[model samples]
Target: MQKISPCLWFRNEAEEAVDFYVSIFPNAKKGEVLRSGESGPGPAGSVVLVNFELFGQSFQALNGNSDETFNNSVSLSVDCKDQAEVDHYWEKLIDGRGKGLACSWLKDRYGVAWQIVPELLPRLLIDPDKAKAARVMAAMMKMVKIDVATIEEAARG
Candidate 1:
C-alpha cells in the first residue's frame, strides 16, 4: 500500500480519462467506480469518482464539475528503460489522441501532460563530465520524444 496517491481532477470526464489510461497501460487495472447519489451533485448515477491502478500505482479521479483544467505545472513522468520503451510509451500516449511537444513532453486528449523520458536521460545529465552532459542536454532539448541513441551519442562526444 502506497502512502499517498495522485488524485486527478476532471470536469465530468473522469471515467473517460480512466478508460483511456487503462487502455494504454498493459499493467493497468480498473478498480471501484463511484457514482453521485440522488441528493444530486451531478445527475444521479453519474460517475463521481473512480479508482484504478496504473503500473502498480494507485490513482483516483474525481469529476470536479468545474471549468478548471490540467496544466503543465504537474505532469506524470514515465522513465523508460530504453529507446524502445520510450518510443512505445510516447507513441501510445499520443496515437493521434495526444500531441507531442519538445523534450519528450506531450498532452493527451484530456489535456493531461505527460513526460515520456528515457531512464538514461537523467543519468547522462548528471554525469561528472560536464561537457558530455551539456551535449546530451542540447540534443535532448531539440527532441520531441527522447531518443536513447541520440543521448548516448551526445554523451560519447
Candidate 2:
C-alpha cells in the first residue's frame, strides 16, 4: 500500500482511461475497481473508482463529472534513456487524439499532460560550458517533441 497515490478524475471514463494507461506501460496493470451503487451519485454499477499501477506507481481513477479537467499545472514526466525511447513514448502518446506541445510536452487524448524527456537532458543542461548549455536549451525550446540527437549537436556547438 503506497502512502500517497494520485487520483485522476474523469467524466465517467475512468475504466477506459485505466485500460489505456495499463496498455501503454509495460509494468502497469489494473487492480481493483469500485462501482457506484444504486443509491450513489453515478449510475448504478458504473465505475466509481479504479485502482491501477503505472510503472510501479499507484494511482486511482475516479468517474466523476467534467467540472474539472486535466491541465498542464500537473504533469507526468517520463525519463527516457535515449532518443529511441523518447520517440517511442512521444509517438505512442500522440497517436490517437493527443497533441504535441513545445519542450517535449504533450497532452494525451484524455487531456493528461506528459513530458517525454531524454535522460541526457539534465547532463546537457548542467554542462560546465554555459554556452553549450544555452544552445541545448535554445534547441529544446524550438521542438515539440525532444530530439536527443539535435540536443547533443546543439550542446556540441
Candidate 3:
C-alpha cells in the first residue's frame, strides 16, 4: 500500500477514466472499485471510487461532483526514455479528443493534463553552453509534441 495516492474527481466517469488510463500504460492495472450504495450521494451501483495503478503509481478516481475541476495547473508528467516513448505517449494521450499544447503538454480525453517529456529534455535545457540551451528552448517553444531530433539539433547549434 502506498502512503499517499492522488485522488481524481470526475463527474461520474471514474470507472471509465480508470479503464482508459490503465489501457494506455503497460504497467497499469485496475484495482478495487467501490460503488455507491442505495440512499447515497450517487445512484446505487454507480461507481463511487476506483483504485488503479499507472506505471506502479497508485491513484484513485472519485465519481463525484465538486466545485473544483482539472486544470493545467496540475499535470501528470511521463518521463520518456527516448523519442519513440515520447511519441507513443503523446499520441495515446492526445487521442483525437484531447488537445495538444505547447512544450509537450497535452490534455487527455478526460481533461487531465499530461506532459510527455523526453529524458534528454532536461539535460539539453540545462546545458553548460547557454547558447545551446537557448536554442533548444526556442525549438521546444514552437512544438506541441516535442521532437527529440529537433531538440538535439538545436542543442548542437
Candidate 4:
C-alpha cells in the first residue's frame, strides 16, 4: 500500500473508471468496494467508493452524487521506456473518449488527465546544454506523448 493515494470523485462511474484504468496499466487492479449506507447519502447496495491500484499507485474512486470536477491541473504522469510504450498507452487510454493535448497530456474517458512521458527525455534535456534542451523542448511541445526517439533526435540537432 502506498503512503499517499489519490482519491478520485466521480459522479457515478467509479467501477467503470476503475475497469478502464486497470485495462490501461499493466499492474492495475480493483481492490475493495465500499458500499453505501442503508439510509445515508446514497442508496443501499450502491457503490460509494472503490479502491484501485494502477502501476503500484493506490487510488480510490468515489461514486458520490456531486458536480463533476476534473481538470488538467493535477495529472498522472507515466514514465515510459520508449516510443512504442508511449504509443501503446496513448492509443489505449485515449480510445476516442477524451481530448488529447500537445506536450504529452491527455484526458481519459472520465475526464482524468494523464501525461505520458518518456524515460530518456529528462537525461537528454538536462545534459548541461541549454541549447540542446531547448531544441528538445521545442520538438516535445508539438507531441501529445513525448517520443524518446524524436526528443533524442531533436537534442542532437
Candidate 5:
C-alpha cells in the first residue's frame, strides 16, 4: 500500500472507470468496492467507492454523481521506457474518444488528463548544451504523441 493515494471523484461510474484502468495496465487490479446501503444516498447495492491499483499505485474513486469534472490542473504522468509504451497507453486509454493535446498531453474518454512521456524526453530536454535542449523542446512542443527518434535527432542536430 502507498502512503498517499489519489482519490478521484467520478460521476457515478467509479467501478467502470476502475475496471477500464486496471484492464489496460500491467500489474493492475480492482481492490475493493464499497456499496451504498438501504438508507440510501444512491440506490441500494450501488457502488459508492472503488479502491484500485494501476501499475502498482493505489487510488480510490468516489461515485460523486455530480457535475464536477476532471480537468487539466491535475494529471497522471506515465513515464514510458520507449515510444511503444507511450503508444500502448495512448491507444488503450483513448480508444478513439480522447483528445490528443500538445506535448504528449491527452484528455482521455473519462476526461482524465494524461501525459504519455518517454524516458528519452527528459534526457534530451536537459542536455548540458542549452541550444540543443531548446531545439529538442521546440520539436517536442509540436507533437501530440512523442516520437523518441525525432527527439533524439533534434538533440543531435
Candidate 6:
C-alpha cells in the first residue's frame, strides 16, 4: 500500500471523474468502485467511492452529496517534456469546459485547477546567479504553469 494517498471529494461524479482522469494520464488505471451498502453512509447500492491511480499516484474519489470546493490553491501539476505535450494536455483538458490562462493554468469542468508546466522550468529557475533567477521568477510569477522558452529567455536576460 502507498504511504500517502490523495482523497478527492466529488459532488456525485466519482466514477466519471475517475474514468476521465485515467484516460488523461499515461500510466493511469481504474482499480475498484465501492458502492454504498446497508451500513454505509450513502444509499445502498449507489456508488460511494472510486479507487484509481494517475501517473502512479493512488487516489480515492468520493461521491459525496455536497458542493464542490476545488480552488486554485490546490492544482495538479503535469510536468510536460515539451511544448507539444503541454499543448496536447492543455487542449484536451481545457476543451470547452475549463478556462485557460496564459502560461498554462487551466480549470477543468469539475473546477479543478491544473498547471501544465514544462519539465525544464526548475533548471532554468535555479540559476547560479541570483539576479537571473530572480528575473525568471518574476516572469514566472505572472504565469500559471510556465513556458520553457520564455523562462529561458528571462534567465538569459
- Highest-TM-score candidate: 5
Q: lDDT tens digits, residues 17-135, model 4?
A: 99888887887889999887888668888888999988777899998788968898899888888889988888888998887887989998889888888888878768788999899
* Cα lDDT of model 5 by residue, 27-67, tens digit: 99898899989987799999999999887789998999899
Score every model by TM-score.
Answer: 0.96, 0.95, 0.95, 0.94, 0.96, 0.87
Report the C-alpha lDDT of model 2 over 65-96, residue by residue, as the tens digit: 77789999999999999998998888888876
lDDT of 5: 0.91
Residues 63-88 of candidate 6: C-alpha lDDT, one tens digit per residue:
88897678788888888899789878
lDDT (Cα, tens digit) per residue for candidate 1, span 62-153: 99999999999999999888888888888888879789878989998888999998888999899999999999999999999887888899
Worst 10 residues of 4 by lDDT: 141-150
Ranking by TM-score: 5, 1, 2, 3, 4, 6
Among residues 3 or more apart in sequence or in different chains, the pairs in candidate 3 whose N, CA or C atoms overlap within 3 Å are none
Off by over 4 Å in 4: none
Give the Cα lDDT of each candidate: 0.91, 0.91, 0.90, 0.86, 0.91, 0.82
Error of 4 at 121 (Å): 1.3
RMSD of 4: 1.3
C-alpha-based local distance difference test score of model 6: 0.82
Q: Total clashes, candidate 5?
A: 0
Model 5 weakest lDDT span, ten residues long: 93-102
Please report, as a residue range, the 10-residue window in candidate 3 with the lowest summed lDDT.
Answer: 62-71
